[model samples]
Target: MSAIPVKSKIPADQQLKISPFKEVIKPTVPHKHANYYELILLEQGGGYHQIDDHQYDVSPPTAYFLKPGQTHCWNFSCIPIGFVILFREELLTRECLDIVYHLPTTISLSNSPSLFELAKQFCQDYRIPASQGVLNTYLQLILLKMNEEMATPAPGHQLFSPVYYQFKALVNEHFLKIKKIQVYAKMLHLPPAQLTSICKTASGKTPGMLLNERIVLEAKTLLSNTHLSIKEITDALDFSDASNFVKFFKLYTNLTPGQYRELAFSRQQ
Candidate 1:
């Protein structure tokens, strides 16, 4: 049940997915893509949530900001109820988007109940069939409050800028098809060595390391959140085969995907 990440060929202003599903259907398995950002409100159920390398037990009043390329998934005792607002980068100018992006995408609303309440209210208001102007106003206010409350960005905040953003966007799109830094270098029209230099400067990691991080993040998300067979997850991720995915998982996590999933679920019990 992994939802493959889709690239937005369309512009952002016209691209938003808002819905309320109460059917208790399986949640989308953890996966990653670029181009879209999400504001999620979990008002029901409890589960293991993996966003990037960070995992937590998601409960009512929990809010998470999911940026493009971060993987996520859930494990629940019962079907969950939540509000998910998915929007894209180009929907707003970089100045405004930077405010929200600077907020750590993974956060616990329980730490700030009042702010959480305000977020819920904002979501309610945005859901109304209001004029574009009104909706944009509400969105800005919400982001402003979040920015005020969010902790200062880490020292490496520079990684969130244009070149780094472009690099990450590329990883989200091609991590499966291409595993080499040289491949990404070619796609970005830069020499492999130059790309390496840029990544090291921006993220304090080599291009290859970042690519592997993206792949491992996706692997963990799928293993913990979805019902997909190992073979399916492996194939979808463009592994040579399941064995390769398994080998890589073991190399990084020191556990098989099945073992990791079993332990993750068992912890919830």
Candidate 2:
């Protein structure tokens, strides 16, 4: 069975859902949210969080912000206590989205005891009167504080340019139809060499590699979440044929489509 993309399942009329990490089952199957962001306030846990292709060790007392459409899975060694706050894209203020929650980041919040308490209060206080507004306000506070925690630059390395953000935006939009770096470079109005330089400098990968990352992410989601056969997935993804799609998936993931699907599903069990 393929793991289909799960759109947020929180009941309608409510824009937020908060839960604790103990409630989260282990080895969360690889999946993506089609509509919302998952902000995990993991105060206690020991494991690895797989976001897209990057695996981050779960250092207790860390805050993880996952953007929409990104795939993730969890492998925690023990039951952890923390709140997982889910919010739709619209709930975030424009400034918050653009500034605070632009990318997936996990940083230790152990030093910010007050911040942790605030999150705890949010989870506990949501059942009280005006909970929605209260939660929204709490979310805003959490984002702002997390922004401060993330503000420190990594020593000796600079974050990528806003240009790379533009590139990724284009990639997210057209990864299905456009796979070539040249097309994306032209669209960005940079020469291929210039585009390559920027991409390599920013992410240590070529624009072409980033393009493939997006496609493969979607492919993995489909394989794990749906029952569609390889041929159907090929057609759904606009591939010329099943064989070509298998070849493409294998080149990046080192596993054939069938193998990947089985592996992801087995872990879900």
Q: TM-score: which candidate is best?
A: 1
lDDT of each residue in 4-122, candidate 2, tens digit only: 55566576566787766665546777677755667888767787887765678888788888876777778888777788888875686755655543544777786687887887778
Global fold similarity of model 2 (TM-score): 0.67
Candidate 1 lDDT tens digits, 1-269 = 55445444225556555445343646555566456777776766676676755677766666678777676666666767666666766566555666764667655555555655555565676667667666666566656665655567333444555666688888977888888887788888989888888888877999888899889888776666567889988887888888888998899889999999898677546
**TM-score, every prediction:** 0.72, 0.67
**lDDT, model 1:** 0.69
Report residue 82 deviation for candidate 1 (angstroms): 7.2
**Model 1 regions lying over 4 Å from their true place:** 1-13, 17-35, 42-55, 59-61, 69-83, 109-128, 153-160, 226-234, 241-246
- The C-alpha lDDT values of all candidates are 0.69, 0.76
